[model samples]
Target chain A: MELQQLDRYAKALIKEAGRKIRHSLTYELVIESKADANDLVTNMDKEIEQFFIEHIRKDYVGHAILGEEGFGDDLLSLNGYVWMLDPIDGTMNFIHQQRNFAISLGIFKDGIGVFGYIYDVMNDELYSAQKGHGAYLNDEPIPVLESTTISKAIIGMNASWVVPNRHIENEGLIRLVKDVRGIRSYGSAALELAYVSTGRIDAYMSMRLSPWDVAGGVVIAEEVGAVATNLKGQPLKFLGQDTFIVARKSLHDSLLANYITLK
Target chain B: MELQQLDRYAKALIKEAGRKIRHSLTYELVIESKADANDLVTNMDKEIEQFFIEHIRKDYVGHAILGEEGFGDDLLSLNGYVWMLDPIDGTMNFIHQQRNFAISLGIFKDGIGVFGYIYDVMNDELYSAQKGHGAYLNDEPIPVLESTTISKAIIGMNASWVVPNRHIENEGLIRLVKDVRGIRSYGSAALELAYVSTGRIDAYMSMRLSPWDVAGGVVIAEEVGAVATNLKGQPLKFLGQDTFIVARKSLHDSLLANYITLK
Candidate 1:
């Protein structure tokens, strides 16, 4: 299928999924934890994942799928048309606040991302991108990030990275927080990446994120002249959990060389 | 004047002021720094403060105001009807993102909070409270906060508190960030307080804020049974720059006893 057709279908499917989730907010939730107490997953998350899986399987049967909620196909490698999905990216926020969660989807043709979408469910804002056609927030085209140093740039980062954590050195993250113009934590990686695409924030970095968590955002960020890399200033592996940073080119390099130290 | 009358007037005035600020977003901004480079004051901030001063002086001539933009009265005592206004509570966010800033107003009579309103200008969310009456978010009555322990609560805190700041001990804040269910930094004090009032977040704390920043939020939060205090667990002085923490009764006490070390 063409990239434009795939992007159109992805947008429609995510919006429909968002509508279903919004209607489910009033019902009693069946909640469960994935990794630990703070790692939450709800029945609604599974339902949404299943919804996406059914739509994609029926419409694009040739495509392979990798999804967060175990509702999509198992894959050994990105050898063909693959769809990466995070059915509900911020499940903790979804369960606790009922806002700030998102549906993130990225389409890659033989490991090359062709389309991406991040839908802020409650706010009804859709951020999407097609390769070489540029990124957009809703219908408005997002501009490329302006040049700014770390001292003037606002970063989207969580406090979890600054305290004792397994992935990165805490001291470096602490100093980075103080050095930036400001730090913001919205608790949703997809939305944070979307913010970077729109220049609402200069950069977004997380200590550890899975392929689906960064897939949609990386595609969108790349279109707007931002670079995505792991803590060591290497390109994202798109394979599994790893330290990730999506920032403007110069700021990304400065953060990697000066502040971010991976443990 | 009656508290109801004052509340009505404050709501209308803030709505008008929000409209004006939103309209000014199209024009080129005249930005200047106050204390440091990150501390910004825009022409719109001054214009909005002037707008409030003019309306208050013309309509409620007997009332006094303490405004952030230095356009209102200055007094040592809060004896009569006094308005505490932060024309733009999150000025940095306003100048940069144009989204997260709010107009905060708290009306005091004889040194006690009588009416409060915090208007999220871009989102058009108005959080208001009249003393002895219930709090509201855009005419909908907000409920008193439900009980939650610190381990299960989400905190709205800035990163500045956790990294070598003057007000609170950095080590204490670092531990606190690790102890909470999660930490969020929205960069808007009024919106953070409003979130607590509406149960969107469980608590909000800041190491340093002026009276106008927390005044409107204090009254609204109080209506919902949340307590506001300094890090030392005393009532906020509402004088100049002071440390502030607003949370549920139990969480407030636990934070002071366990994590907060006043510097």
Candidate 2:
């Protein structure tokens, strides 16, 4: 029931996991592709996920954990204290560049996000938020998202979103891309959300993201006054994959009304 | 002229400028938009360009300079040692994010890129190459790019290139985007090119890039056995802006034959 204590524990756990992951970088990595060749999953990802699950089970025996690596429970509902964990977001970047990845963790109680933490493992930046306590990047408090028009705003997006596919209509996404100030893709959804909270980029859009991918970011983003929702301007589903866009209030509205209509 | 001496001096000068730029981040920045709202230029960009010019003029007189900030010579020919400089390659990112920008410098000997350096200022990573010697990432030798199939390669590209634009046909670029393993946009052509040299990304495509943006990258890319050329499969003009695609040999040909044909 104490949100502050829960937030503190989450941050420490994520940081410790980050340290362990970084230390293991020198060891030989066994990487394998999942789903497809582009969708890579390394042993590190599973290892870190198991590490979190073990700690959570040991510390909070009653809590439920949902993780990307399949080392946690498959809860039919997030009724009680649930921890959504993405041990190594941007695993491809970790395998190729060894940078631009993070450990994302979000804690929810009774279906409400009470604490969130995104740790940029290589950069040593911890973007964390406790409900009603606001967001902080490391020790400094992050400012609320500022209102900027589409023409003046920079966005975080992947190139696949603009390509014609089964998802949204590429024509509409292309138009949005043309009108924005700039587009950046760091290959990590969690870091992209942290960037939105920090004003590094004005917004973040992706056609498909898992619950674990956006869990930590949504909380941090909401704390910084950014709206997190699906392309249809609906609240994201916490149980599965969905289309997501997070931005300032005005920009979010404009994007949903004008560009995201075709989807 | 000793090429070794020139290469050593260029590396030192770029690294020094990088240190100065990082130090100036704390000071007040005078920012301005050029050409359009998104096209940004800052006083620090001009300051760094001027610094390079002053040093080049003082140390090696009569050398031609082609710099992004226009503090260099207006030359009709690369008939001597020419220094191509992009003081800050990602000006918008520099003003907003204070990171992801770099000081790019390339020394050409009578129209040939002899030495190249791309210094990621915030990360303190220097990607450099001397002609016939090898490419390097901060003293570690960088190996030549390995041939990769289009289906298994990650491409670095901006969203603008995939949209219906005045330059390329959107259909072809869209298809290419779909076919690639992954796509990334870092907002800096210089950094993207450096990534190509380092095998961080397999290819980098741009509709319009000035000589300074890819000069340093071109040299380093060549040292790593990656091909750098305009979309038409022709060598890039060293004197002005042009469309560019830098990739591994096989992927470069594949893109030109299938995707870049419409340009």
Clash counts for the predictions, in order: 0, 0
lDDT of 2 by residue, B1-263 (tens): 57778877888888889878876664433333223323333677888899899999999998989999898999899998899999999988986788898888888989999888999999999999888989999989997777879998889989888878889887888888888888999999999998888888999999889889999989999999999999999998789888899998879998988888544
lDDT of each: 0.85, 0.86
- Could you report the DockQ of all the candidates, in the order they appear? 0.68, 0.78
CAPRI class of candidate 1: medium
Q: Look at candidate 1 and tell me the lDDT of residue B69.
A: 88
TM-score of chain A of each: 0.92, 0.93
Which residues of candidate 1, in runs, are more than 4 Å off?
A26-41, B26-41
